[model samples]
Target: MDTQYTALARRFRPQTFSEVVGQERIAQTLRNAILENRVAHAYLFTGARGVGKTSMARIFAKALNCPNTKDGVPCNECEICRGISAGNDVDVSEIDGASNRGIDDIRSLRANVNVRSMRSKYKVYIIDEVHMLTKEAFNALLKTLEEPPPLVKFVFCTTEPNKVPDTILSRCQRFDFGTISTDNIEIRLSQLAEAEGFTVDQEALELVARRAAGSMRDSQSLFDQLLAFGAQHITAADVHRLLGTAPDQRLIDLIEAMIDRRRDAALSQFQVALNDGVQLEAFTDQLLNYFRDLMVAACGAEGVQLLSVGRDCLPKLQEQSRRWGLENVVAALQIFADTKGRMQRVTYGRALAELALVRLSLLADMERLDDLLSQLKAGNAVVASGTARPTSAPPPRLAASTSPVPAPSLPAQKKNERLTPPPAEVASGADSPVTGSRDPAPIEAAAPPPVIAFQPGLEAELHRLMLSRLTDMTGTHLAKVVSTAISGPNRLDFSFSASYDIGRKACERPEVQARLESLVKELTGQDVRIQFRTVVTEAPEAKPQPAQPTNSRRKVVESPEDPLVQEVAKTFGIERWLRQEVLAEVVEAPAGGDLPEE
Candidate 1:
């Protein structure tokens, strides 16, 4: 039977330190340590999975125990090296800490450390997932690690260093591995494809690299999947379809729609993605990453180096950067990030995705810092230079200014009286028919009687207004008390909820009540009743507008001239007068020129 097709990852697992991809610094450091014969008794390698932790550990073991070591590297020809590579070396033990985490296993290991190597100079122990060891097991191994025999060495590998005890960590020399860049991952994948006699497009390799998300193992696994699916050559479309990723073009289109504030287009693209069965959470994550790239591009950073996207895509990112400043991109990223958490709880993930896209589109119009500053400066210049004023003639005066008159005594009325103002003509104090002298009119006599149009339960509007104003004044602390009921046509009974003790006390205070009553009387010309009760009235329903309400034919009201407009007018006058008198100004020719010399 034909052997099952081995994955490219396992097929091309690095045999020697030099063969490893994208971990030169780590490889060089370990090599130097070996060459100098200053190897530590215990070694701890930590990083994300698949960046060559396990592979490097094995290679280090081989280098340590090789028979023909000239500089502290394994000679592949050596019998010891071959046995270790084949997992048959008696002196080189590879233990899985996850399965054998009991104290007894560690005690067994401690017992074996004293045995001399039969075939090699040193006996090396490689413990994978070292963090899985129990506390007792860790303590059991600590004594041996602190003072191991000269012939024995320990290599502990873990993805999480924080889970390991500090004591164990203190006994080991640690090496941190960093994620490989997409460029490097792609280069390595291409080499594998070439060596395997399979044609792979560069874009396809890039897709594999990006899907890897900085893990060489993941990248290799993806490469193997793609090869298995296609059996030979692979294209970008195949990779996108297989990975359930949005096409590059579609992603660009979606980004462009967001930049243009075209919500409809964005929704349409999202629908297409939904129809294609793209994972909502994954799509959002990808878009966020894309926006991050745009942000980096906008900041003039080395975006290509930081991003897993293609080099050709850099231009698109740069163009998007020009349209969306860093702040807008950052805000979009935050909105999407927040949406991701919400999406997990939502059953309608597509709806959440669409909402996020629409929100981002709306936020695209937000003013960037530079643009806002520019606008503010322009406005300040207009204010400072006094240039944003109309040059039209001022309105005609309404007669001449009149002398002030004393206000008349207010009339006593029921609390239900309406607060409407009297007609302008009647209130203007027009000339009396018989009196020749201009005498001041009495305020009470000139004012019309107030009308009371009662809406049975509309008193809550007043209470809401009061509460809002109170909240504004007291910084959100005192507004909780106000409740209301229609006491009569013009009176609203105010009360406080049980929870608002401070508001109740304030309302009961004579001084506070008097001030509130005075403000109410001044504004509405009616005495409002203040009371404390637990009852609440239903809020009024909002009324719908008429389909075709009568349009008002009333004359337009004109606003009074503002100070800025007046100041601008005054400045212009000086300039105008100077221009008319000092500068050249043509006077009307003396009535149609004089008759030719008589």
Candidate 2:
């Protein structure tokens, strides 16, 4: 006959209270309670699956009925201990609550509780998945729970405590078991590997531990799978292959490429991973975890440990930390966190993951404090040097050409200068016009033609002037609401869009209406009607044509001043205003104004 190799989890199942890992506090508390004879009639243990809830329950039962007990621990050699361990104890019963959760089961349990123990001082009943019990069953069992026989002890275990009724929870002493830590799981796995004569790397064990996600049963199951995959020795590469996980080296390479600003290399690495059939979401999750580790290491906390990778990777993490500032690391983490949620709804998960990676790489290019300061210093130097030098002086003015005709000095002077009579003579005698008169009609001197000021495009000019004056008076609140349009010759309409209640209110007020009317009359020298109406007039659209070249024969048009342009010029300074002035001068100046001086 050949002997078989029992799994490490079963081989090392905690037979005594002290053998349990990471649960010493729970064991000690239970032992103290038992010693003091303060044991509750019913006990409920709740936790994630497989953190030794069931095992602890069995240990407690053996401690209670051990034939020869020492310090609240069972003597495994005793017949009662052997019977309980073998699941054959006459007075101890293990019930699967999931299978027996009806009223009939409760009735059977009620009938059994009345009977005395066959071989032990107490009759112990253990029910797993107690949350699965039906409402009727719970109601039926409530009486038994409130007053069970002194010889009966009930133990209930459940993964989901919320499903259990409040009455049942209140009746039992609940013990909440926490998920095992990765360190504890790693230690356990390492010990098991050592005892089984199999070599395992630290990274491999850590991989197993993390894959377990803090569940001892899961870790043990994974350990068994890994052992089977790698017959005698387990390495990180083997673990990666078995778990379908990308290697840490590959991840480090990708991160290094991003940190180094090697966009092509990073993209190539991503393509390779995709070609290998590695899950995009999984790869992203791993990279995100790596960055998280880097952030932790950057924080300089001793407790920040990577449970999935080797300690050797810490150097790489530190090196990568130099490339990212605190803010960028935080922003990258946020992007990855958001990407994780988005990946679920997206049909093309690979593209989204790749996009996230590319975004992160670009974020890595963000300037650090020192780099930004250096750039600022360089810019300031250029500005200072360039501004210190004056622009080239306007080309030297050409000396007036010497006139060839030489006449009397006074006559030459008279020819160069215009001669005009005194103001009294000119005012009294209008017939004698001034010399060098380009316009002969000016001889009339009729009140100086009322100082005629030519305003090009009077309609547009009036509309702009009115908008500015109205905006200044009302501020932005009313300015945005009121719209002005040229209705007819020298006539402008004041209308309100649906957005402006204030505009309507102001228009209704006689004072505001009167003030606007007077201002228009003063500015345009035209009688204007300040009529208020709800109807909104459509703005006239200019016909579209091919864009005119700089020297094309198309007429140049000036745009009305908008609030945004005025506000920006006011806030930023006169530089923007000066630039606008220069543009206007360039556009309106005669064609020869910009010609090089000869």
What is candidate 2's lDDT per residue for 4-75, written digit by digit as tens?
977767777878898777788888988988888888899998999879888888899999999788888889
Question: Which pairs, if any, clash in model 2?
Answer: none
Candidate no. 2 TM-score = 0.61
TM-scores for every predicted model: 0.64, 0.61
Q: Model 1: clashing residue pairs?
A: 416-490
**Candidate 2 regions off by >4 Å?**
1-6, 273-282, 342-347, 364-598
Q: What is the C-alpha lDDT of each candidate?
A: 0.71, 0.71
